[model samples]
Target: MRYAICFTPTPSDPLSQVAANWLGRNVFSGEMVEPPAIRGIGIHEIAFHTAVPRRYGFHGVLKAPFHLAPDVSETQLLRDMMRFSGSFQPFRIPRIEVARLHNYFSLVPSVPCEYMHYLASAVVQHFDRFRAPLSEAEIERSDPDGLSAAQFANLHRWGNPYVMDEFRFHMPVTGPVNLVDMPRIEQALRNVFEPVLAEPVTVANIALMIEEGTGGPFRVHSLHPMGKVSARKIA
Candidate 1:
């Protein structure tokens, strides 16, 4: 099974709840809740269904898609990731209501937060063992965002080109927006996710997501809460 560690927000985390509702069962076909995507709901649903996996919907991706390496043992990788993650204090991100990325709609942090950066960096830093080098097909899926020669070279080295400086934190709401429907879709998203937008984003856990099949609407495999640390007394 292909797997990745992610930050899956819970219902108590309103933003996540709303995003979840918006995506519903349209994202997946397993134990996940929400109804299936049926025709005539909207154009976005039709198009989204065409490109999306049955188990995918909602939440931001802290870690890009990576497969567990056959040669690398999973037990060792989790232990190393936990050890590496032990030092950081649990922190929160500012509220993110609405934002746009290229042709897609997204939820973005209202302000920059160290937790976001640290989390992203951690994924890049230690989870290196799980990821396979990005293939041409993966890059092709990116299309216009397709890697240049420099990016292709970086993929060989980093397994994902959008690491470090290239990383931009945003939770995608759609594939690419059609200008004519932009306003209607935006409002629909706003209405569906309003409760989440009104609150601050609490960062307490990291989720492990998996893809059981070739096509995905990926869903949570497991979750690891970032435990709070008591401040060490100075010697």
Candidate 2:
């Protein structure tokens, strides 16, 4: 199994429910949700466009997935995560929007957030000891040749290239779409997510997610609240 640290809204959060419906799967529950029908777009097209994000579910990655070191235990990792989260206070993203990220669409902050960056960096750095180094296959899978020099170096040193200075908080919604299809996909995403985005979203907890095996959907294992005061763990 591989473990990832992510920022997923609570399963009951309106944004989470809407995203799960749009993507046809709920990462929190590991269950399929029927996709809503769209005029002029076939269900198959919607399903196809969402296939990639559906597997990962609706969450912004904090720490990329990694194998546990042989000497590490899941219980120990959970304890560490719980302890680590206790030091920080919760913050909010003032606004969010459906934006094109590279070749795909995602929900991203409407403005830069220093607090979000700091939180993500802390998560990446703090739990790194639990990670096993990438295997040859994992390295090959990441396609180092496609990465920029700095990103390549970061990948080697941190196990994920997109953390720290490179990190942009994104909750992915679809697989790569052809540029020609971007306008329609963007409209679809905005139609579904805009209402939820109209209000500020809370960043109150960090979630521990688990993938049972290769190609499996990640499921929420636990949520650790962020604050200086001790908080209850949610499962």
Clashing residue pairs found in predicted model 2: none
TM-score of each: 0.79, 0.96
What lDDT tens digits, residue by residue, belong to model 2 across residues 80-126? 99888888888888898999989999999999888989999998998
Residue 219, model 1: lDDT of 72
Q: Write the per-residue lDDT of candidate 1 for residues 1-235, one digit (tens) a residue.
A: 5666666575455555545555544222244445324333564563463234224556567677777777786676666556555555556676776776677787788776667876886777678767766667866665635677665565666666666666667777666767876776677666666655775767666666777687655776555556545522110
Scanning candidate 1 in windows of ten residues, the lowest lDDT window is: 226-235
Candidate 1 global CA lDDT score: 0.62
The per-residue C-alpha lDDT of model 1 at residue 50 equals: 25
**What is the model-wide C-alpha lDDT for candidate 2?**
0.89
What shift in Å separates residue 188 of candidate 2 from its native position after superposition? 0.9
Best by TM-score: 2
What are the runs in model 1 whose C-alpha is more than 4 Å off?
A: 26-54, 139-145, 148-153, 228-235
The RMSD (Cα, Å) of candidate 2 is: 2.2
